[model samples]
Every structure is written in C-alpha cells, then in structure tokens.
Target: MAEHGGRDARMRDAEARVVGTVEFVLDVRVEGMVHAQAVRSPYPHAVIRAVRTDDALKVPGVLHVLTGAELEADPSVDPYFGSPRPDQPVVAIGKARYAGDPVAIVIAETTAAAAEAVPLVDVEYSELPYVVDALDAARPGAPVLHEAWPDNNCGSWRLRHGDCDRAMAEADRVYSGTYHSPSASHVPMEPMVCLAQWHGDRLDVQTSAQAPHAVREALERMFGLAEGAVRVRTLNLGGAYGAKTQVKIEPMVACAARAVGRPVRMELARDEMFQTTAKHAATVQLSTGVRHDGTIVARRVSVAYNAGAYALSSPGASGQGLTRANGPYTIPNVSIDCVATYTNTVPTCPFRGAMTSQLAFAYESQLDEIAADLGMDPLALRRKNLLRDGDVYPTGEQMHDLHYDAVLDDLEHAIGWDRPPEAAPPGKARGKGLAIMLKNTLTPSRSQARLRLRADGRVDVHSSSVEMGQGASATVLQLAADHLGISADRLVRGFPDTDVTPYDTTTSSSRTTYAMGLALQRAATDLKAHLRTLAARHWHVDPQDVTVGGGSVARRQEPGADMAWEELLSAADLAELVGEGTFAADFGLLLMDDPHDVHGPVTVHWHQGGAAAEVEVDLETGRIEVLRMHANCYAGRVVSPHRVRQQNQGCAVFGLGPTLFEELLYQDGTVSNPNLSDYMIPSILDVPEVITSSALESDDPRAELHGVGEMALPAVSPAVANAVFAATGIRLTELPLGPESVLRALDERRRNDDQEGTTR
Candidate 1:
C-alpha cells in the first residue's frame, strides 16, 4: 500500500506539470471560433428600456450581437437555470436584477474586436430601488427581486426535533446570540470560461466546471437537444472550490455559437467572476439551553441566508445549514428554521464549506458563550457532549465511526492546549481555542466508470469526475492500478469527455474519491474476472482454478503455467477487454421525504473534523496574528497521506481569509471591492509559522473510505474567533474580523470595563 501510495504522488505531480503547461478553457482553440463578450448591467435593479446593436454589428470584425429579447423569443432556449426552480435567466430579459448581470453577447472575429464592440452596443436602463442585505430584503414590503415571489423569500427550510420552548423553560440557564458571516468570492485562479460549438444537431462545450454531466444535461434541456446530443468536456481546472459546481456561462456561449454559425468562446474577467457568484452571507440567531453541569438540553436556531437576486442553490444551502445547525454535539431537543432570501445582489452559491461553515461559526461560538456563562472550561463542555458511536443525530440519523473525542484529544495535544505558553510581550495577549464540525456527504447520486484493458497490458479508466486540483484523478488511478494487480505507472488517466466516459455526478460534496472510487474498483474487479475466464478457457481449466496476479494469469495446480497478460490476450485473439460498473445510492434508504422532519437520515455519511488555533493579539493596532494552527479529521483510509495533509492545511489557510480579512463590501447594490486589490485572500506571508494536521483512520467497516477535501475548513474560522474571545474576553459575532472591527470591539470593551470600575 505504501509503495502504491508513493507511485500515486509521482503520477499526480506528472499530471500537474503537464496541465500547468497548457492554458485553461479560454485558450482552448477551435477552428472557426469567434470571441464573445457579455455586456453586463451596471444597475443592481433596472428596467431594460432599449438595446440597440446597430453600431456593434457595423464593426469590421463583429459577426453578431445577441440580446436577451432574442433569447426570450426563441422557444429552444430555456434562458433560465437553477435548482428547485429555474429562476436565473441566461441574460437579463425585461429587467436586470443585479449589477454585472449579462444582458447581451457581442461575438467578433477576435477577442479584442469582441471587447471593443461590447462598449459600442447601446443599452438603456431605468434604475429601480434595490436592497442587498438579506435581513432588509426579508422585511415586509421590501423591494422584491422576483415578481413571482411577493415576500422576496426564495425558500425556507426547518428542522424540528423536540419542543424547544418547553426544553428552554425547564433548563437552568439559556444563552442567546446573533452571528453573521459575510458574502465572499471563490476567486479561483482561472475564472469562469466556456467554449461552445454547434455542429448540425449536436452541441459541444468545453468549460471549466466541477460537474460536466450536470452541464451537459442543462445544455440539452436549454437547447432542446437530445440527451446524447450535447457533449461536455473538462480539462484540468486551476481551482473550483465549489463555485463551478453548477452551470455558469455555458448557455450564453452556446447561444452565441449557434447564432454566429461557429464556435464561441467567453471568459469572465476577475471583476465579473466576483460579481457572478459568491458565498451566501448569513445571519444566524442561536439560543441554547444548558444545565449548570455543562450539558446542553435544547437548542433553537434561526438562519437567514442571502440568496441574492436568484435562488440558484440557496434552497439546498439553506437546508444543509438547518440540518447541520446542531454541530457535532449531542442535544436532546433542537429546532432550526433556515430561510433563503432574494436580494438584488450577485446570486449566492456554495463556497468551500457551503453553508456549513456559516452555521459552525454560529453554533461553535455559541458553545463558547455557553461555556463562559456557566464558568466551565470550553473544551471540557465539548468533551462532555461529544457524540459517540450509535448516537442519534437531531435528524434521527444514526452516527457511525464518529471519533470526536479522539480527534479533540489529538487537536488539543497538537496545539499544546494544556501546556502553559511562554509569556507574551507586555502589549500582546496570547490564547488558544478549539472548534468541532460535522458535515454530511451528499448521497443518492449515481456514479459510473468504464475500465478497459489494453493489448499491451496497460489499463485506462474513464469517468466524468473533473480533476479540479483535488487529487481525484490521481486517487482513481491508484485505486484502479491496485485493483488490477498492475503497477500504478501502467495506468493512464482519461480526461472527462461526455461522449466517451460514463456518467458521473458533479465532483463536489467530497464524494468523487469515495463514490467514483467505488465504481472504478468494481469495474476493475469485473475486468479481472473476465481475464481469468479467458485464461481458463485457453488452459482448459475451470475459471476458479485460474489465478490472476502481478499482471499475469496462471493455473493454480500446474507448474510452468504462468502467462503474461499481453500474451494471454493475444492468444485469445482479443484487442482489448472492457468492463463497466456503477454505484448508485438507494434514495429510499438515504434521503428523508421531508428533510425538515426530525427523523431519517438526510445524508449518506457524516464528515467529522476539528481544529485548534493559537493566536496573539496586538492591543495597540488591534491586529490578531495566528501563531500556529492544528487540525485533525477522520479519513477512513489514507489514499495519499501527502495529499490529505495538503488538503487539510490548504483549507485551514483558506479559512484564515474569511475569519480575518475577506468580504465582498457592498454600497447600495454595487460590490465596492470586486477586484483582488481590495478583496483580500491569504497569501504565503499570511500563513502561520507552525501548521500541523493529522488524518485519523477509522476502524468501522462502514467507513472504509471517506472524503477529506472540505473537512477542516468549517472548523478553523470558529476556532480562531473563539481564540480571539479567549484572549480579550470580547465576543465578535460577525465575520472578517477586520482591524477596524477589532479596534471598535476593543474600545467598547474598555468603555464597559471603565464604567464597571467606577460603579464599584
């Protein structure tokens, strides 16, 4: 296993090097392809009074300019895409709901020409009142982004397990607080790009996406094409995080391609990427009932998610938030009400941790608040309520292979939780804090793979799982090689091509390595059986007597009967052997009819993780520097220890930006800091001095393998916030604890302290 693991790293690095040399989708050249640029709306909400494309079409290289009116008139173009409801239009039709909303596409012979023509296209708009805040949008008589929804509420989800009012009435103490998380951008190095071409009845698209199959389905539905007529191809992505999980700009490019009778390429600029989709900024109100002995009796949480102009995946995100509001602890009674509100801002989608991170920031911070109120150690309270094996979740799902206690112990030791730290400078304060998280692995989805054995004894594995720098392709290669009894070097990783590779669900929810890996294993197993049957027929022996090992087949009882795989295939007169396998979750067993109902499992598997952080705060500048961070999570079996550690550490560092200095600042309805110059992400210099992580192996057979991609992210932010509270006894309930906010909090703390001293 160790040797195979090493080979996986080498193969992954080789693939990375090859991908690094090539440009992304924007640079994928196709003959007779034209460049397309979108003319976006400048107003957050406005009436599209007129659109004149005469000047744009008169440009020397301009081929065509397509407007939303044309799309709305065409019966073939659906023009809208979203989950639960198709609300987001491909282009602004009669009205533009948000700034940067695409209203027209200008296609020209060259990219420069297309860009130049974009400004020449005239679009008249009448501005309308707009609200960007989620809470403000939810108010009665607020400006509704969608006319179909009068309340401006996109969707609402609730989970009711027990009687929260009664439980709180009987508890010894109750603590309540409101926590806020800001909207942030994914900012993948390679922004959203798509290249689409139409050939007769078929439509082909090459895009930077996490889910090619989903994109193919969306395109087929929008273009009114046959199921197999639309093909989606994906290359190595610079990064996806979670932004690329859904359809972005493929529909626009496809429309432009068909209009111009040639291929069309569109790549979003950095500012456009920022305004297209972002993380849902959420406001959570949490009330916890606890006993004097540090036992949580009941919990009630109300969350409002900023769905921003359209309900893309906000319903699902809101459901996930409601389900995970209880965190990783054991509570008798829990009530959660989560709602996604429509606001005139960029539509919200999943980020690294989805809405789970936002909820963790609330519940974990509330846990610390409760601990302080009870005068009990925060870690001790967590240890007391840690869920054990067989414990039931608030949703009535049975917990399995939960190693929260063990993970906490490892995290505490790694962060020196019990050890007294060296004294800090007179003006600096140092403290340690911990936070735990639980996430559900998406389920009830289908994943299929095709394994083909070449004539030269090599193997090729094909699937639609996008290699978005998550080490998914490398893991699949290792699993296939091991299962086929061949060296990992002999296997070739196949690119994701919808026409060739079997269908796979999107590569999000950390399910690629677990779900797709299972499919690949089954396919390889079937191929091996086929090889054994072929060898047995040649040797005139029973199939059971044929043994396949080390890329060779032999008769078990006969001497000198070993034959190389290639020789056997040649003798059988076969060019290659192919095997297909699929893994489908039983929705009957996995999904609950009403996720809001308290019973039944809502997810296929649970992801458990925790983090510990040590922070030093400067009293003068209000700057908080993380001295070190330690994270731990259960990764049933380590595919590549190096990759696993890298993912954990990367997520930890990513969490730093959201916790300290990342936010999409909004004024009226425009994003003030749309570019990286103003919107901050953590750089190498921002990383801590000592970063440590550990992946624990689970003993339960049910947890043979699990995902580690997003395990550590949700926990890191709350851990840092808790550390800040520990250092200064000031509780910050909002995200991106910037220097200004920190200073304001400090001043408030000092004022309150001075008042107390005078009164005494």
Candidate 2:
C-alpha cells in the first residue's frame, strides 16, 4: 500500500484548534496598536456635501479622523481598487454608492473610544434614487451606479458552439424555466480583521485573508510603493469560504494608520461584516431541447448576476456560471450569455461553491421537469446524456478522467435508488431524487513551494496556501512526507507569510491541493537530489551511484552502506539544504481543433460530482425534512479519505442553509438580517438523519489528484428540490424553499387541478 495516498489521516491542526491553541488574526496583537472604526452612510446613493469632525475629535482617546474628502485630496494615495474595474473606493469619495458605505474612519487608542466617536463623526448627504435588483438595474431608465457603465452592467460574457437556434427549432420538444437564488452571507465564525503598521518606507500588514499575495499587490499599487516594500501575513483563519478572498478594509485601516502614525487594527462587527460582502443573487433562464427518447440536443442559458456595488469577482464568477449552467450532459449545440449588473447593495464576492450552486439548482431541477414531461425515469434520462471521457466540452476542451457514472452508482447504492418508495407517516409524503454537476477549478494560476532540509533530519515546507479549516496544511504535509519517505512528525508546516512563504494565487476555486501539492512534490524531488549529491561528496562516491530514499542516503553499489540524513549532513559540514519548485497551469486548448478560437480553457480540470436525497414533505404545511443525503465525487486520487468525506459532509450542511432557510433580507437597500440573531444558518439539529459521502478513485495509472473542496456542493439544493417535486407533483423554481412559498405553490397546484377537473 502507498504510504499516505489512501490513508485516512487526521488533520494536522485538529488538536490545536480543539484545544484553543490555534491563532487566528483576531488573536494577533501588535505593540502600540490603536483601534479604528468606520462611519457608514445611511443612504444607498448619496453625494457628500460637508464634513463634521470637530465633535468627533473632542472625544477622549480619539487620535485621528480620516474622511473621504481628505482621502480624495491626498495626492499620494489612490482611493480606488477592484478587479475587472477600479470603481470601488477605499472610502466614499465624492459620492456614496450604497448604504453602509464608509464615509470616514476614526482611529483611537482603544476600541471603545473608536466606537464612541463613530456616531459623532456623521457626514451630510443628498440622497439619490437607487435600484437594488439586478434585472431592474440593467434597464436603461434605472438608477445607474457607475458612470462608465451607463447601463449599470459590470461585465458580460458569451459562449456559443454549433447552432443552438437550429437545434432548438428542429428538436422534438422544448422546455424553458427561470430559477432564482437570493443573496446570502458566508458568516464565517471570525469577522474580518486587519492590522497595518509602517516602518520607514516599508509597510507590514497582518490580516485574515485567503489571498495574502494579492492583498500585498493591491496595497503596493494603492500606495504607489515599491513592489516588495509591503508585506502581508495571513495566519490560520477561523473560516473564510470566499468572504476573505480579496481586499477588504485593509486600505481603510492602512490609511487610518498613516493618519495616526501608529499601528491600527480593525475588527469588523457582525453587522459590518454583512455590509462587507455577500454571495451574488442570480437569475438563471434555461431552455433545453430534448427528444422523446430523453436525449438532450440543444441548450441555451441566460444568467444575470447581481454584482452589488463593485465588479470585484463578477467577470470570472459570471463567466464560469454560464459555463457550468450547461450541466453535466452532452448537448450538440449550446449557447450561453451571462452578465453581471451593478446594484445598490453590499458588494458580492465568491461563496462556498463560487458560481455553481445557483446554476446547478436551475439546470438540474429542469432536467427532472423534462424527464417527467417525456414520461421517463429521471435517472434514466440523466444516464443517457451524461458526459464521459474523450468527449469535447462546450468550452472546446477535450474531457478526460470523467467518473460521473461511478459517482452516480455510489449515490444509487447509498440511497437505495432501486428500492420501492416507502410509505410516509400520517401527513407526510416521501420521495427520492438525484442530481449531478460539473465544476471547474481556477486555471492559468501558479503555486511555488520551498523545502528545507534541517541538520536534525527534519524537513520544513514553506507554502502560502491558507488553512481556513479546509485541511490544506495537513494535505501539504502528507504529500511531502510521502514523497520524502518520512513520517509526518519529521516535517514542519509553514503558514502563509508573504515575507517568508512563496507565492500562491488564492485559496479558493479548490485548486490548492492540485496546484500547491504538485509544487511540494517537485520540491521534495529537488531536495532528494541535493541530498544524494551531498552524500556522494562525503563518501567519495559518484553522485549518480548514491540514492536518497526512506529518509536516508545509501551507496547503490553497497547495499549495507546507508547513512542517516543527520549523520550525512554532519559529515559533509553542512547545516541545511534548500530546494525550490514552482508549478504554473498556463497552457490551454490542448486538444482543440479549431484554430480561430481565442478563448483558452477556463479550468485546469472538471470536478464531476452528484448527490442523491431522500426527503419527506408534509402535505398539509408544505414542510420538508431531508431524511438522508448521499454525495459522491470523482476525486481522481485520494490523499486522505477522512478529510475528503468530512469536506463533503460540511458542504451538504453549508448547502442546506441556502436551500431552505438562508437569505439576506434587504429593507430599503439596507440588509435587515445582518446579525446572527436575525440571519439563520444551519446548526447541529439541521443535519440530515443519515448523511453519507464518498470519493471515487480512478483505476488508471495516469489519474491525477483533484481538489474536493467544492465538488459536492453544487448538487445539494437541486437534489432536495427535485425530491420535493417528486413527492408533491408541484415544481418550485425559487431558492430557500420556505414553507410559505411551498404552501403557496401547493395551493396554486390544487386550484389548477380543480379547474382541469371542471373542464373534464
């Protein structure tokens, strides 16, 4: 058996976290540090007219108050920062785009002092008309958020293959439906925190961020500093999901620090955290053309994403949403158009599943609709159109290593899909449903790692992948230990520090293990080579004749001549050795035959996964209780079975909230449920009665390791919804499948049935 490939090893930091020894950014404290707080705007859209800081300055312990007017007037600092567009200002400059927008920052010697002065530094504003919905914001007459984008559209994308119109027109039948997913919060245990200090021309920052290097780059650009003048450090995060992916409150705190001439730390309150970022509320329209035999011939999809106030990650998220909206089926012709529109709300970033959940909820639920209309079993319909190895995806990339059938087979066994439907209790109806999806990882990215061999026969691997409770640190150590032929205890794992650790793109998109793991593997190989050279020099043997394996060096000619690493290093008069490796996923269109195609492959590999759900719905109240859930994924190779399964189970629970109870409530452009007391998330009691998860391993020798972070999430909501439809013969297309909505749909269904009966 492999040393660590298939083992169900425990997480490296599990003990530390359980014992309360893990250090998050919130626990970090710098000497002479001050506290900072923001004064938020009350209007969704308003023009700043005057500043009133005299009263705030009178507050005891308040050191400085920095306003948007001062920030805009400063020639050294660039106020705007964001991806795809630089429209989001560090503080509201001439105008505040949304409610809760920061208009001024107050820095004080204590947290209480800063909090006390925040309300005293209120600013004057002239309110303007605002639009909150994506569809309404995109119309011509709606309130425009950005002048550059007059139509209030942030970004747009289109993917066309073959002839969708012709195929749809010539199909046996066509079905269309629209699905909606409301904005939701990540609600990580630890709210956002940032601490920044300046030393001469150099600046240092420690934050709870998933992308420290990206933060460093943004800081440098914002301050016009040298490339390496700024250093960003990220410790273990309580939980980020994607809330902490990009720049958030760092610049504001940095500016406050500069004003106060002291280290400034800001820990956002729960309400402030809600105002920071959210998952994009999306509307997806799908039209599928299918034959009488359950073959899908054509598909067209339109997706409009509410980008909120900025285009931080909308371009990539919406484009990927369009691609995944095609589902895991084979269609000869496909066309997709996805757009992100600006709205008067808190900006949206990536969530747990990125952009896959909402799209999956739309297409997968509609697939069951098609199967029902055609009088065919839903499972049979999915099997007939499932994409397999050697198939060409709509993105023009050739597919390989697909294990959708295996995943489906596992789901079937877990849920007893072939068994007869069981009877429900008095007022309940029982049903079963299945859904499958294809997710893609971030591509054209890179990761670098360094392995240092110590004189004590130990190894230290420096990596920039943040833990964030995803088992990345543990996975890295496992891969390195296996490659070095050493026990895990002999290896030391390093967290993310831009000054010491190597560069990584970010921790989202589920690419850390695949990209960073390969980098570590390469670094281990390089270190082994260095060990062999050092051993050969000490023993007066040819370098090629010496081998380094099993944590020791041996002369190939003499089987009994093996020297321990520490002994060999001491004999060679060397204190330590270092090895560096880098992995970049840059190439694309590997098998595309079309020379005119300019768009490269959007993902490194497709994550094929599926879920099966057994639910009991109350016919009288339209309440749903998920009895059991089984999630399966084509994980290619398993590093730690325990971690993979744990991730899948967590994903099911995470997906459950958005499916049944979670939604950000907006009242007149401001979030009403910003705190835990109002916003409901899944708790221990909400877990399904019987939940099972598995990762299918590939038998092929060339199979590669695929990240399982987001593999099982996309199908969760759709599976539960499909089961509900099967139980009641009523289709609901909206999210958060609340009791009120379900009951309303049931009443409407009954009325339709009565009308048809009268006609009959």
Candidate 3:
C-alpha cells in the first residue's frame, strides 16, 4: 500500500473538475424537459393587486404560467421556509416586499420561449413607502415591513458579562467609533440553478446546493410528499461560500414541474441572482474603556443588520455578531446588542464570514484607536488582552487548546511588525498594521456516514456533505483510506443523495470536515472490526486475537497466518461488509438560552485567526496599494496540505474585495450595480505581491482538526484599515475605503492644520 498521510497527493488541474463530465447537473437531459423563468416585480415595496399570466401562457411553446396565488391556494404547497421564523414565501403572495420578488413562474418547451414570455406577464402593484437603511428601519415612523412586527425589528440578541457601567466609570480613558459595511454579493461562478422532475408520486431534484438533505426536507414539506418521495442530488458546486446553504428556489422549480407534468429547469440570470441572497449590510458601534496600563477594562458593542425584505438567516447572523463582538480579547466587563432589522431590499443570508467580518471591522479598528490613546503599540495591546487557555468567553464558554499566541507570533514575525514600513515612492506613505480574530463554530449539529466494503477490496463512502469546492470529498477520502490502512485509490465517494446518504445538518458554519470526519472515522473503525470478526471465524481463532492491517486480517501470535480481505469475505459468503456511524453534538451542554449564561460550553470549538499587512497610500490620489500581507490560522491538523493552503489564500483574497472595492450599490431600495461591470471584485492586479499564510497544529488529541474556511476573512478588513490609518493619521470607519473618502479626510486634516498654525 502507498503512504497517504502527510503526502501532497491532490487531483491535478486536468482531473479536478467535472465541467465536461456526465456528472454535471446542467448537462443532465430528460425527455420532454421544459425550461422555467421567473416574472419578478419592479417595485421594492408594493401591494400586489393582481397577477395576469394570460399573455405569458399565450406565447408560442409556453406550456403553463403559475402565479403565487395559485400556489398559495393549493394545500400541498408550503408557502414559507426558514429557520427561527419561516417568513420567506416561495413567491410573493399578497405583497411584493423586494424588487426582485417572483410574482409568477413561466414554463415553456424551450429556454428562449420562457425568456420571451417573462416580460409579458403583468403584475399590478401599488407602490408604498419603504426604508433601505438598517438603522433607519429601527427608528420610529419607519415604514413597517411586517404588520406583526410593529417596530420593524426582525430580532435582537444581547450578551452581558459583568458591570459594564461601573467598569466604564472607573476607566481612565474611553474610545468610541461607528463603522459601516455595505452589502456584497456571493458571485459564485454558477448562479442558482435547479432541475426538478416529478415521476409518478416521487420528485427528484438536481441542483447546485450546499446541503442536499436540507433541500430534500424543504421539498418534502412544501409538496406534502412522504419521507422518501423527494430525492435531492447535488453535483459539484462551482462555488458556494455560504450562499447556497439554505433552501432557495427549489420549491418554486418543483412546483412548476408538478404543474406542467414534465421536468423543469430554472437558472437565475446574473442580475436575478443578485436579488436572491446577499451579505447583511451592517452598522456597528463599538466603545472601549481602558486603563493607562493598556488593559482593556470594559467594551460595549451595538450592531444593526439590514436583513432586507425578509428574514432568512438574519436572526442567526445577528446572534453571531453579538457573540463575537469582543473579538479575541479578554475584557472582564463586556456588553453587546445586535439587532436584525426588516427593510425593503433583497433578503440577507450568510456570506463567507457573515456578521463576524463586519463586527471585526468595528471591534478591531477600535483597538487601534485605544492603543493610540494609551501611547501603546497596537500589537503589544493585543498581546496583553489575548485570551489564554483557561479564559472564558463572554457567552460563558471556556477556551481550551487555544493557539492565539502561536498564530500571532508567527504572523508578526512574517510581516516584520517591529521593523519600519518599507520605503515608498515620492507621493506615497507606507505603514504596517495587525489584527486578531476569534469565532466559534455553530454547535448542536449532527452528521452520519455509511461505509460499504466491497468484495473487490474497494470501499464506498456515503454522506450528505457537499463538496462545494472546499475539498471536502478529498479530505474524507484521505481520512478513510488512512484509517483502513489502504491506498487512496481504493476508496470511492458517492454523490450526496438524500434517499441513500445519511442525514447531515446543512454544510455551513465550517463544520463539515470536523463533524463529518468524526463520523467517517467511526464508520471505518466499525468496518475494521467486522473484517476482524469474519477472519477470526474463518481461521477458527478468537476475534480478540485477530488484528486488521494492510488490507489483511492476521492472528497476533502467528505472523504467517493472515487472510486477505477478499478471501475472508468470500469464506463468510457475504457480498460486502456494511458499517454505520453517527455524531450528535452535546446540545444540552453547549447551547445556552441566555446570553449571560457563561458557565456552559458555548460552541463546538473556537476558531482563531491573525493577520498583518503592509500598505502604501498614494498621498495625491488616495489610492492604497497592498505591498505585502501575512495571515496565520490554527487548523489543529491538516488532512491535505495543498487544499488547506489553497483555502487560506482564497479566503485572504476574498477578504481583500470587501476591504477595498466591493459593495452592492443601492438607491431608492433598488440595487444600482447588479452586474460584474458595476460591482467590482478583487482581481490579480489588486492583491499584494508578497502574500503568505500558515496553519498551526494543536497538541490535544480531540483537537486533531479544526475549520479554516472563514477564519482568515474576519481579520483582513481590519488589518488593512489599521494600516491605512497608520499611513495617514485619519480613521476610516466605513468599508470599501475608496479614494474619495481618503482624499476628503486628507483635505479636512490640511484645513485643521492650517487653522492651528494661524492661531499659534
């Protein structure tokens, strides 16, 4: 057998993707298949008086036009799907809350026919007053999005530790700042696409989704189907980044297919995909009180997230923002309040780091300000307040196996934080800045795996975890092959099909590898035990005396007495061996109802990240150029070194976009830049020349592997912002620190300097 662990064995470029393969969902063709298109509303907020689909049905090749009213009237259709509160309707029912809310679905014999009929459908609407700003929505007299919620507040989360008021009063100095982060798009290469087919009483859905089981459950509930009646199979996702985790447009596609009695495909256009989901635009206010000795005494954080027209994952995102408001510091007195507000815009869902990134921009930026006030070095201040192994989080969870010191030390050394900034051109100023982050994985999750050892010495592994470009499948294969003492090629991973694979909570919150790896490990162990038992029976030896190794079972006392896996299976008269394993987090012990409950385990594990950046600011044009960047994270143990490096680098670049140039522009509750031409993302030319990253391993056995998916994102923005402040002594409190804001701040500083000089 070939060695697998600690090896750089990864699929090459030519063999990595399924673009031209038969497994691609978009390539799957069914006889008599029809294409589907959505008829969306133009008004941001309006009362839908009527939806006339007669003209759309009259189009050539148009098979059927289904309206929200028709779907709502049918008892089989579940109108809403979401967590904490099921408020998002499959389609706009009586009112259209956002501009892109689908009013009707048009099915046709050809894709072009469906596209031609989309503009023909007429929707009567009475436009109403709307609010787009999150903070404004919470104020009095703002247009109420939902009548049930009088204050236009979707939900709020709060956490309190000690006496914040007393701590602030006794402090020697206090620093406060308000930060804003604009909404951003996911921009996955593949837009939201679903192919739904109904055969007799069963429904099959092929789509680009992060969680097949979650989609299957939503489809079953919406169509009133039995447990096995709905099957969801997800192929290779182009990219997910947390956008495709929840149920989106699957129910609508399934409903259209059932109505037409034919398979239907729905793919969102680039502009329409922008309206489906987005990052929550947030306003974060942070205040910190510190003593002259540089010890952080108390901190207060308030965040308001613009959840858009509907509540998708806003409540949960807000809870995370509140929980992580204190960053990685060990402040004794801390208070945080986060609210998700209802507004007239597209619904917001988890995107990359979700609310943690936005909150870090505020909390970490405030740390720099606090350092300047106390005449302390920023890195020294962070080191002083860094959480130790025995420290407790404000949520009442105790930290264990923390590697913050190691990661921070590595990042600072890599970036040469003690050295002066690199020399810049005549018109540029150079500076270096550092930021640290701490996040907790969403807990109370569950995962299960089933493994089958074939007679041909091959193992088939089945699980509901999606491979959304995160190398999840590859990681599982490596772990299973290593445990089985076999080569990697001997393992075959099955596609995620809910009917065949075991249940898994949605593959978000960076929990797939950690939670699912545990299940796969147990499944492999079970298979080994079964193989040992079969070999013992065949050799007339005690099961305890038989050991499994190197694809063979052997007697411990007799070195020459060994039976191959194939021979043992053949003698047992069994075609294959089956094993099952499950993992359920201790929700009772880890979950807390009160934010002040600091005595319980708050999450499955704590994710830590550190970042340092060297930047050059053009004094004339206000353009910022990233000279170098270094990011370090704790990975516990890396299953695949190549994949881990790629993930860290990719996340670092992803962070650069929102830090410098990406923002979903909106005016009058309508997205102004809905296409790539208008909304800018980081290109190769925009990134730093010397980008580097590293992963830290822990000593604890249970901390064998941790999630690194979103760890690098939360710290990138703050690191850049701090560097910008260092280059020019002006604090930037908003995201996408464009040249206009920088130039304006510089001009104001010049004016203040002139006034002071004249007075002197």
Which candidate has the highest lDDT of all?
A: 2
Instruction: State the lDDT of candidate 1 residue by residue for 121-213, as single tens digits.
Output: 999999999999999999997887888898988877777777889999999999999999999999899899999998898999999988898
On lDDT, the stronger of 2 and 3 is: 2
Task: Name the runs in model 1 displaced over 4 angstroms.
Answer: 1-8, 12-19, 588-591, 699-703
Compared with the true structure, the alpha-carbon lDDT of candidate 1 equals 0.86
lDDT of predicted model 2: 0.87
Q: Report the lDDT tens digits of candidate 2 across residue range 1-760.
A: 1112478667766788889999888999989999999999888998888869999999999999998889889999998998657888888888888888998999999999989999998688899999899999988799988888899877777778889999999999999999999999999999999999999878899999999999999989999999889999988998998999978889998888888889999999999999999999999989999888989999999999999988888866777776677888888899988889999999999998888999999999999999999998888888899999877778877777777778778888888989856999998888898888888887667899999989998888899999899888888898888888888889987778898899998999889988998899899889999998888888888999998888899998999899999888889888999888888986543223432242557677889788889999998888889989988777778888888898889888888999999999999998989999899999988899899898888875457888998888989999999999988887889999988888999899999999999999
- Which RMSD values do the candidates have, in order? 2.2, 2.3, 2.5
In model 2, the number of clashes is 0
**Cα deviation of 443, candidate 1, in Å:** 1.9
Clashing pairs in 1: none
> How many pairs of residues in model 1 come into backbone collision?
0
Please give each candidate's TM-score.
Answer: 0.97, 0.97, 0.97
